[model samples]
Target chain A: MSRRFASLGLALALVCGLAPARESAAADTYAVDAVHSAVVFRIKHMNTSHSWGRFNELTGTFALDEASPSQSHFEFQVKTGSVDTGNAKRDQHIKGPDFFNATQFPTISFKSTSVAKGADGYDVTGELTLHGVTKPITVKIVPVGVGKGPTGGSIAGIDTSFTLKRSDFGMNKMVGPVGDDVWVNVSIEGGKK
Target chain B: MSPAGMMLATLVLPFVSAGLVMIGAGWLGRRLGIERADHAAAALAVGVGYVVGHAAIASPTFPPLDVTDRIPWLAGLAAILGILESIWPGPSWTLWENRLLLTALVLSALLGPLFAESSENRPSTVCLVVYGLIALASWTNLSGLADRLSGARLGVPLLTVGFGIAIALVVSGSLALGQLSAVLAAAVAAMVLLKLGSPMLLGTVPVMVATFGALLLNSFIYAALPASAAVALVSAPAAFWVSRLGRMERLATWKVVLVTEFATLIPVGIALALAFSASPGYAE
Candidate 1:
């Protein structure tokens, strides 16, 4: 009877010790607030003016630990096939191999590597993969206004931007007239993962 | 001076240099018994086609008024290729020659319809120039094959890999037309240096031509825009002289030229894109 009681106590203690990890994981859940979040980009159309584009369906999760923010991580997956450039014909062309090669590479994604606090915001370094090519990029994420949702959910807002070279991953089809530097603007709204 | 003079300086000189080189290549090919001078001449002609295509429809002012010029540079390149074939028996180079003709034809077919779509003209013609230049690079590769001349001395595999890297940049929107060309020129020039045992004098020209050519072209496009007029004016001389120094330097100048131009243009591309995207009136 004593042995059974002691075993039960040990199991309970182990569970208690691991409780923090489980709870932290649960606390890290994040829901992208669609109304407040966006993924945007700008590229040179000719050498003249910038062409702008955005992806509408941005679905992601953010896992964070308040005590150890370095343990925080994010997973963002955007539908490459969902690119919007305000023109249907051009969108089709862009989705082709010359640009996104969406059929061949359907998802645009980012997985967080490290995060550091800065004066104005935080620098988030991650591996961003687009069109089957992946590269390491650092995005300076400026904390936009953060607040509570009407539903009493904790919401954190972040605005970040990064510059990437398209050729690093293999999308070197368009040049001469079209500017190459693809600038990405990300507005993220996260809740506990 | 006439508006033409400014345009000629900004847009015409590269073509002239390209043409002069074609003439020299033809003479040299014959002198050195280097097989096919015609192919080199044809390549030069395509270079002229690129300049003329870019310069054709502008106001000849400091900033030529538009962003997208669709002046049929491909047609000129095609015509020259056609002429070259007739002058020289090209069956020896069928594989590459055919691919060149086919690609030009395809581009023309794809873009040809747009010519008649509207005469309203895009404010900046950078996109079209980019497409044309990519085609030019394709042509260069094709011509290189036809003449049995490996211009960069990099094996076909490395060249393919470099092109693949470039394509990734294009798709990801990290390196646009200008940056792509600059990088490619740099890569090609570096290859020449490496292959030639880093010969200081002979190796410098291609690097100068490729790097400065890209920067000058980009700066000229920027200058042609009235909105970017100030920035272009300040940077144009810098582009010109940097290129001039690249040209005049006898050392293996590829590293300096390529790195400087690339570093300078990359940030410019990011800033220009962000600035334009942030503007209110522009359509996103």
Candidate 2:
């Protein structure tokens, strides 16, 4: 009975000793709040006007290490079929092969390769896979702030904007009339997970 | 320019180039020291050049490698095969060599689309087997037709035109596909002019490669039209066999052309109707 008590005490001590170490190594993880977050893009239309479109479905997670920002990681996926440009006909057309070929590719995704501190916020370099093509892209992520949510959960807000040429992702169908460069803006609200 | 204007220009560029090449085929053929300038080769080169140039101009930065891009690469492979066939001539090729080449070209064209489709849902092995069989059968049928009508001055050109028109109609649902269809039409139009007088056999290899490549792109990559519709359009050339009917035995050349066109139009019309019906309002 004494030996059993001593073993139990040693196990308890070991657990207590590892808790702080684990806490120190753990980075805060946030689950993207889809209801609040949005991925939107704008492209030139007929070289005359800018047409705005947005993806309805977005899911991602990010690990933030405030002490060492470079250790932060980010991942995101946008459903190509969920593209909405207001007009249903146009949305369907974009979902077709002429633009997205969503059936074949399904989704456009990004996975961060590296993160670095920047003057404004953070420069996150990642591989963006779109239209079945994967290319390394960097986006400037500006942290909005971290605060307590109405639900008493920790919430973090981030804003990122980047310009990507559609042709870079093999969407080289209409060029002159519809401009090639596409401006993407991401506003994300993440809850602590 | 407007989108329509851009599309028209893209479509016309290949036709103009083909016409120029056709007009100069004799001189080019003589200059190259070949029996003929090889109209099919010219078509392949011009078609591929236009596609590449269009891609380059549209997006100076080429897209990263992907399965859909294989269509252009396969077209390039077909062009290389066409050049070799022109230089070496098909009669000298061994039976096994022909078979191997045919298999390679067909497989390359089919695999890319198959892989693309497989990603949508898990395609069973049975489906793949059926697909492979269909591809082989289509390749055999089209290649045989091309071989039989090779030396016929008007037959191949008429069939090519029918194919181009059919593909254009089928792909009209999608602007990108329509552009590709236009490129194909321009290539064949050029081939028709180039091979007008000399009439060297346009080898079956390029036809199989380009036709199958385009069909795969239409069915798998873009899926703008139903697969059955694309099949009907591509296989419409088999209607060339209609010329072998008893009524066509003693018919005049113009009558033959008219009859063949009529027969080919049946399938082409059906394909067009199906494609347009599939897309309620695909107007760009």
Candidate 3:
């Protein structure tokens, strides 16, 4: 009778949105620590060496679970005008109409729609909006590690790198000289709530 | 094309159109016996140069997603409207009315986007509206100068102002805006090459004026251009009135021109100086 009663309660708990004690109940929410995280990009200059740049301002949040990859999600918003390339003149030109067009399209954003476990880590499919154009992009994100934060909160490190065609986003200017392929590298440190 | 290539094209294409198309159309109009076709040709040449020059830098997107993408298409519209205004046999008031409507449309296209977005960095709506009114008034007076003054008298001031504004924008941290401004000046130079000291105005006046207002507004709102510098730049062309001194009977044309050039340089100098001092690009 005791074993039968335990099974009935277990069934009720499952129906009431409770998970088994051994399994994760929900994904942990992590607010991106902008100070420690960074998004950087490099494009070939004249098809020779790479030219590097980074967005100075970024804000985002993510929910992640290794056990339940389906529940994992990431979203990021980057201020387009904050593009810093070290050279002031080229920075202005890049921010102008020919490139990002920062005034009209002030923000570049990404919101993940799906996440799936891959061989290395998780393959996240999301919409990346850039230069006033939005397109679906899939990126491979690896779980670097996890530790305690300065405030004694849980923390996680994720790393990702992807290549995208500039022409695909309607940025076709100087295609030959500036090259079409841009490689983006992101290292994110998120603090768990 | 590379940036250097784009800059070269910006300066050269307009000169080519103005030099070749303007004279060719005027001569052909006389040969084919089409009246006022020369006036229409002037507008067409400048518009063609402007659109082509801008496209050479950045090909516009389909449906124009970005504000700058509309530049080539807007230049096309201004050319068409200018040709109609030039050829219309309607009353003077009707021509002015058509021009007024065109001004409103152009202002909305350029300034409307800036005003729609609520951002602290952007100029206030009232200031932008007043700036548009100032640009409109500036164009009207410059067009009047086109009727009384022609040749270097008209072209030099425009060229100087264009180069000045271009320099100011570049210093204020927008190479693209500076290049765009220089492109307009190049088109005007082309028109002046064809019709020096002729005492007539063409549709190019409205075309240049409309585009100039839009570019200046973008420079201030989008780039690091300061508001005070924009005002001084907008009012820079008004100094063309000083060229009226050439109309004096006893004044040597060279003496009158020298003084006119210096007078036109004042506002541009002030604007450039202000841009250098106040621009966030420089301050940072």
Query: Model 2, B135: alpha-carbon shift in Å?
Result: 3.9
**Cα lDDT tens digits for candidate 1, B1-284:** 24565344333543454455555655776797755454444344444534442333221222211112222233344435444543454565673555445454544433443354332323236765664565455345433432332333222222333333333233232223333332333333333333333222211222222322332333233212122422322232222223234343443445544533454454345435543343333123
lDDT of 3 by residue, B1-284 (tens): 66677767779986786567778776876787766787778888888878777776666677677766666677778788777777664687876776677777776676555565533355577875786577668767877887777566777777888889889987776666677778877877888766766655567777887787778767776677888898898888788787675455257656666777888899999999998886445224
Per-model TM against the reference = 0.41, 0.79, 0.88
- After superposing candidate 1, which stretches have Cα over 4 Å from the reference? A1-12, A24-26, A40-55, A78-108, A117-122, A129-135, A140-156, A161-185, A191-193, B1-14, B32-40, B43-284
List each candidate's DockQ score: 0.02, 0.37, 0.37
> Model 3, A1-193: lDDT tens per residue?
9999999998898876555553455778788888999989999998889999999888888877777899999999999999999887678778876578788778899999999999999999999998778999999999888899988999998899999998788876667778799999988999986
- Over the true interface, candidate 2 deviates by an RMSD, in Å, of 3.8
**CA deviation > 4 Å runs, candidate 3:** A1-14, A17-23, A44-49, A87-93, A172-180, B1-7, B27-34, B115-123, B246-252, B278-284
Give lDDT tens digits, candidate 2, residues B106-225.
554445444654366445678656655665565555556555443343445354544554354434445655555555555555565455444434542465445444545444545556
RMSD of 3: 3.5
Give the per-residue lDDT of model 1 (tens digit) for A1-193. 9999999999999899889867756535677776667999999876789999999878887655445667767779888878998876567557653467454456788999997766776667899987556788887767676568888878887777878877566655455356668888988888743
The backbone clash count of each candidate, in order, is 49, 0, 2
